[model samples]
Target: MLPYSEEHAQFRDTVRRFVEREVAPHHARWESEGAVDRDLWRKAGDAGLLLTNIPADYGGGDGDFLTSVIMIEEFMRGVFSGPGFRLHSDIVAPYILHLGTEEQKRSILPRMASGETIGAVAMTEPGAGSDLASIRTIARREGNELVVSGQKTFITNGGLADLIVVACKTDPAAGAKGVSLVLVEADRPGFSRGKNLEKIGMKAQDTSELFFDEVRVPASNLLGTEGKGFAHLMTELPRERLLVGIVAVSVMEAALCWTLDHVHERKAFGRPLIEFQNTRFVLAEVKTKVTVARTFLDDCVLRLMRGELDVATAAMAKWWLSDLECEVVDACLQMFGGYGYMREYPIARAYEDARVHRIYAGSNEIMKELVARSL
Candidate 1:
């Protein structure tokens, strides 16, 4: 096991305390409502839990990726159901901070760090999923401003987002080379939101379809250059995937630890379930997988900090650990027998929650494709 720095451990303690007091208690209510309350976002901001990577001048915590990881693990420990603040903070914010002009950052960063503004990256269109290069959203320069058209779907935090990082083709014929990212404010004219989508899992996150109908913004809002979005995305994709991988592994660790506690106390055949050879073996195997997953995840996390983790390795971490999450949760669910199937049970909720791991964050199949490229 890699030794966690004292600072990381201290950060974890802060996150654990915050999660216990502020997040875990309210999570059940949030899940039942199909969306978390907007107020909790401010609470997170006040707690200094959002956007850990941005500099302190921009209203961020000035913390590292590990800080975000600590918060994510604590969030998952509750029930793995919450808004996608971590995604926005760790993935989307970095995109802008690294690429956006000073004016762009000035307009958006403070509110985002305060949690008054939610953020979403609109990359996945109706026709585009993992093939982001194929996205049809276009931004045309008309005189002084850029007019954007097209739609995005399955966007996390879509309905509530104050600004969206829209991926569009500035030159349609340029294919991937033409892609550019633009910041579109949510309240702008011609910007409309679709239904808050209902999904099999992650009910608390507001997933929706967003439309851009001739939405015009100053060219200054263009993130980076006009034709560098693809490169920018390539640079960030690994860290994004790594964040998802971290969440997958952390949640599994929480699940395994919780399940063991339950099984050790829950009686079966007049003996504690842990005494059964089958339960023991199941837990043993699950623990082994989780340990292995953690090792890989931690390595990826460290590499990300050192700026050495690449896109292919990130994809591998995402798919493999998430696949392992499903397997471990499935076995843990079975150990509970009928109770496992009940929505009232954490194991049951976890089982359902684990399903989306294979689908979202570019699906496990796409992950394999990305990993294949490295070979």
Candidate 2:
């Protein structure tokens, strides 16, 4: 059995209660609406469920990495299916806390923790998905203000975010060295929202196309320096990928358990579906794979706690577990027979939602390349 401290277990219980009360009842409605209500964000912030890792001095909960991991795991287990909390709290907030100046942090952190503002990190443009050097978004400083101009697509939390951490080219001549990160407020002129792009799954997430047409912001908004964005991205990616790994493993665990339960209750030929040799073998394989995945993921979590989890390892965990998740879910859906194909079934929804894990936050192929660097 995996080990956990009493405090950690208690924290897990808290997360479960929050999910059961706040997430469970509204998930279907949110899924149908293509976006969750804004009030839920405030509820999470009120409960100290968002940005638990940032220090309490900045209005955060002052929780540890494990707390964030617990939240991710619990959210996945429930298939909460809405909001980009992982993208905001787990992924982007660290960049500001670790790298941004005092002014940047003070300007952004309090609102982020309070859920007074939504946060989004814009790194992927249509032209540059995985390849960072290919980014074409330009940020030119004219006097004391940085003028940003570009279009970013597939931005998570794009429609809802009040603050965006944007990546842009500061010196096109310097290639990868040209990139920089800056904070942009949604209320700023020339910074405008576009259509919420329709997607096959994760419909409640409110993905959108963001256009920055000569959006001008104060010098104080530049995160860190003018040319550290790509390197900063490299530094941040391991954590982001690690978070993705945590989500993948947790969801796979939930899906596996869900399938087992589903098959046991669903009978055919006067015997439960679980009685079939095929079903038993399938579940056995799933159980073993999920256990192995948990083992690796938990080890990664420990290493992350020790500040030793590297980019390559995170990539391995993410790609491998995500592939396993898709496989396990597809098998689970098969056990449901025709019922799984229907949109009303949770498994069917999961099957649809799980398809993108292999593709987003960098494709599995790109993940392999990152891992290959270790050799």
Q: Which candidate number has the best TM-score?
A: 2
Relative to the unseen true structure, what is the C-alpha lDDT of residue 353 in candidate 1, on a scale of 0 to 100?
82
- Residue 89 lDDT in model 2? 90
Candidate 2 TM-score, true structure as reference:
0.97
For 1-375, candidate 1 gives per-residue lDDT tens digits of: 545689889878887887888777777787777678898789888878888778998889898877888878877886656777877798778987999888778778888898998899989999998888899999999988999999999988987888899999999999899999999999889999999988887777788999999999988879988898999888888888887787788778888987898898899779999999999999999999988899889898888888999888999998998898899888988888898888777777778888887887788999999889889
Q: What is the lDDT of residue 167 in candidate 2?
A: 94
Task: Name the lDDT value of residue 217 in candidate 1.
Answer: 92
Show pairs that collide, candidate 2.
none
> What is the alpha-carbon lDDT for the whole of candidate 1?
0.85
Residue 216 C-alpha lDDT in model 1: 92
Q: lDDT by residue for model 2 over 1-375, one digit each (tens)?
A: 345679778888988999999888888888777778999989988988888889988888787888888898888776776878888898778988999888778877888897888999998898889887888999998999999999998989999999999999989899999999988999999999888888888877889889999999987788877898889988888888777778777877887877888888999999999999999999898889888988999898888888998989989987998888889888878988999898777777778878888888888999999999888
**TM-score per candidate, chains pooled:** 0.96, 0.97
